[model samples]
Target: VRVLRPLIDEAGYIEAIEDPNAIVITDTLANVDRIVAIATTFDGEAEMDAEVIRFTYAEAGTVATAISEVLGAAGTGARLSVDASSNVLLVRGTQRDISQIRSLARAMDTSPRVAQSETVSTSIYRLQFGEASIVADLVRNTLTGSTDLTNPVAASVGEDPANPDTKIFAVGPEAAPISPVSVQASIETNSVIVRGTQRQLSEVSQLIKALDVRRPQVMIEAAIVEVSGDIAERLGVQLGIGENSQTGGIAATSFGNGGGALQNILVALGQSNAAALSTGLSVGLASDNFGALIQALNTSTSANLLSTPSVTTMDNQSATIVVGQNVPFRTGRVTTDGGNVTEVIKREDVGITMVVKPRITAGGVVQLEIEQEVSSLTNQAVTGAADLVTNRRVINTTVLAENGGTVVLGGLITDDRLQSNQKVPLLGDVPVVGHLFKSRSDSRNKRTLFVFLRPTIMLTRADLEKAAETRYRRAQSAETAVQPRSILKQEKVRKLPLEIDGLY
Candidate 1:
């Protein structure tokens, strides 16, 4: 009624009747036609229509309220309603009113608000080959330009007293601007949640790609060899004298009186002289004159291949191989209150063991940190207990070598010598005759140990296959060399006859 009252008054209508859904106007046809024409032309609503405008980004109720206020102030007979559930505006008006409402909605409905100075977005990145916590820390440091997690502000910005240009102001007119970035790790899911701007998130994603890659593997081969040699000689002469005597009595008796008359006795005494000479020589010579002697006692050369262990591990990872047994030794004894003793026994590995950590560099060079040990049980006695003793030779060092190239890590050379002479106190000093009364012995032993190591970087499947083939060939050769002899020939031999030629 309010919207149509002005038009009716200007057209001089006689009377008006209002109804729930319609309105009646009593006036001249001429005045009615004028009023209709003016209403249609001025309001641009020749016929009533309805439109539903669904909001994409803006709230429907808010937009509807604003449009309703504008229509009321402008005195336009347009009704607007909002459907909060569907986020739409329902307008009952002509085409012009609906069009205007759509324009207003478009202008108000935009993307979510973003701050100019501090805008943060959340993103999650899943890791394939890298640790979540470590990657998170790396991302945080890289995005924030700070290495120190405890104090990021102090670490990122610094001041120098001597240089005027190196001063950084935190709260002054010349203060530096810093961007905000935060990163957190979800270890259970193996992912990292980063909160930062689009630019920072992009950088974090790139860094993660570079860091999360498959690690290269290294195959290590070790050889433990022991060489030993021994030589000994002895020369001596001995002489002595001996005396012997024997006495015996024989009695033939028929009775006590007859035995006393027929008694016989026998006695013997003898003197004898003995002499002995001994000489021993051990040398590495092949001559017919001393072939027998040299074969009996000669310089012996022996080589012992203790162990050859091979292991594969990732770069910067530690791998260990033990080719022996663990032996228990008594370390201490404790007496209990009831006079019972308890011995504390510790088991130690007594054999060849090698532990290596290899790191491959960019230029096919391997850096190795190695610990090699060779331990064995010895006959040397322990003073306080019956526990056996052990001799351990260990080498702990680090070196660099080319990939697939063998390098000698370390070596040990040991020399042992012993000499002894024994004789009668004054006879040993008798120049030429001393040899006859003296004995002499000499012994010498030498041993050498060398450790060789080779590292092969396995970066691809082909490399791994090649290394495996090599190891297989080596093991096959070793197995063939130590194969047992055949007993089939011995089984074919016939046994000798038990009663051959009636000799039984």
Candidate 2:
């Protein structure tokens, strides 16, 4: 016993800190970090039938002591006995409590630490019972109704911070003088841990699983890529989108890869079964329009987020941002004489906000409610004040496309800027030298903005699970885990706009 005291102390320490079932997995292979146990069940008792517990790696000598300490704290059926020649844990128990021992072993195999570090991975959705909230109420009601189970010490819902839709309800066992050594909470992987006699834990696990059924998960990702003004304008001209008829500026235009040098590219895209480019091509001629294409091929698909059918919703609003400009306002007062007085005031213009709502149908059609407000200073004056004018545009329409297609929204937005240059004053305006000084120039730069959207539908969970498994297999099968650094000079690549005849 004195020789095993250190292992017992270590086991007690681990039980106090992390969940008892958490088997530590590390990159150091020589270190012994494996847990093995044989469980036996009898009439009313359970036992760990281990003759020896051997732990290799760093400080391996203390492993048996820790395992003995952990099993001892597990309550009634747990006894610490070991074999000297081969270090293996042996646990034995009565028929009724035998399942608990088996559960402990299984839990260790499925622990998050194990799954993440091991070459093969496996997991089942689990719910963490909440102490408060509707979920908690449900657990309480279920536990109370169950005849074989007693109330748990603690219960709470653990919701995924990134995805609120995924949640787990966790339950804790009643508090004993010393916390049970065998049944420990594994928080990293959100394991559902309940401590009690074999029967009670079994009852609670059933109830939780029955109430909380895992739903198929879908992940959505979006990116915003800003295009340079020069690139946007060139794209617009190549696509044959003329100046905006009403505003006398460039209006957003959509075209396909058809009838241009890019026609071959579109054919290639179709061969790859790219839904965004296949069937019909409604290309919106604007800045950042093709960003979705780049994003889909490189990052989103590679990350396994594109497995399910999903919906892509885009909201874009166009407005002018003005600074150092004064606009008009009015102040009115109701006098005691029952007469109204108004004073004109000039105020600096600030910014504007736009809000839009998107709706999707089962067949993948989308409808959007877009509202845009543009505020600017007016050239004309009224009531002794320069006027502040606001242009509000409201649009409600369905995207002109078939199901599972791409849609472009908010094309009216443009970054329109005006620049002016003037020579120096008086002397600079004189004769020959004045010619240089008196030079005056005005120029305008504009780029149209378009939002691209794609929606995918989630059908089942098997696809996502398979994709993850495949990725893991690929990583493991690779010859070298590290990517080889290139020694050659890399050239920056750009997609050149295609020209049709002499038009562009």
Best by TM-score: 1
Report model 2's TM-score to 2 decimal places.
0.29
lDDT of candidate 1 vs native?
A: 0.61
Q: Write the residue-wise lDDT of candidate 1 on 238-287 in tens digits.
A: 00101111111211111111111111100000001111111111111111
Q: Which stretches of candidate 1 lie over 4 Å from their true place?
A: 1-112, 115-122, 140-182, 186-189, 230-301, 382-386, 415-444, 477-484, 488-504
RMSD, candidate 1, Å = 25.4
Cα error, residue 475 of model 1, in Å, equals 3.4
Candidate lDDT values, in order? 0.61, 0.38
For residues 317-436, could you state the per-residue lDDT of candidate 2 as single tens digits? 122222233545654434555576556565644333233444444564434443333344443344745345543222334443322234444334445445556778886868787877
Question: What 10-residue stretch in candidate 1 is worst by lDDT?
Answer: 233-242
Which number leads on lDDT? 1
